[model samples]
Target: MPAAAHDLRTPLTVVLGQAELLERRLARDPSAPVDPAGTSASRARRDGCETS
Candidate 1:
């Protein structure tokens, strides 16, 4: 794979993994409160590191 694609895929993988975990947790307990800063993707977005 190209370096650019790899770079994009890495963060996307992390985001997708976090999303799946959240989905499972929410399924078990829909009343659970979700923290905006709970995932790395959220932190990246807050820190302006996320391009998309």
Candidate 2:
């Protein structure tokens, strides 16, 4: 169980970091349309980093 949690940690860290960044950007430019579900904005930020 610990190993599984550990394995998931890194990816979750990356996701959380991306989410934090997106939250900032969204706070700064909150005009961007976002899905009501919230994950869309986070995925958009992650995708932005992936492209770059």
Candidate 3:
């Protein structure tokens, strides 16, 4: 099921990329506030794949 594996990998890649970006941003400015909605969306994308 390569297609199914690809579908799952896509979202996980996105989540990881977003997390990396967030990490870099926080590193630059540790005082910056994280957006709750953005965090929720990332978690949703991650969880969505797990439930599939």
Candidate 4:
């Protein structure tokens, strides 16, 4: 139905937008250093997973 399609499309569009943003962030700057383990977002994800 049209309503169901609309419901699914909105979230999919948001997810695609966020993925694009993340891809841009991760593309990185050549002059900056990259640390895989030290980001606060990674720390939060690790902590959240451990608690669950």
| lDDT on C-alpha atoms for all candidate structures | 0.67, 0.64, 0.67, 0.56
lDDT against true structure, model 4: 0.56
Model 4: per-residue Cα lDDT over 1-52, one tens digit each: 9888777767756655565566457657565566667444445445542221
Ten-residue stretch with the least lDDT total in model 2: 43-52
Indicate the residue-level lDDT of 32 in model 4. 54
Q: Which parts of model 1 are misplaced by more than 4 Å? A: 30-52
- RMSD (Cα, Å) for all candidates, in order, is 4.7, 8.4, 4.4, 8.2
Query: Which pairs of residues collide in candidate 3?
Result: none
Assess the local accuracy of residue 29 in candidate 4 as a C-alpha lDDT between 0 and 100.
Answer: 59
How many residue pairs clash in model 1? 0
Model 2 error, position 40 (Å) = 6.4
Stretches of candidate 2 exceeding 4 Å from the true structure? 34-52
What tens-digit string does per-residue lDDT give for candidate 1 at 1-52? 6889779968877876686577667758968877755655556556665544
Candidate number of the best TM-score: 1
RMSD of 4: 8.2
Q: lDDT per residue, candidate 2, 1-52, as tens digits?
A: 9788677766766776777777778877767776575664466555653322
Give residue 36's lDDT in candidate 4 (0 to 100).
69
| Cα lDDT for residue 40, candidate 3 | 44
The C-alpha local distance difference test score for the whole of candidate 1 amounts to 0.67
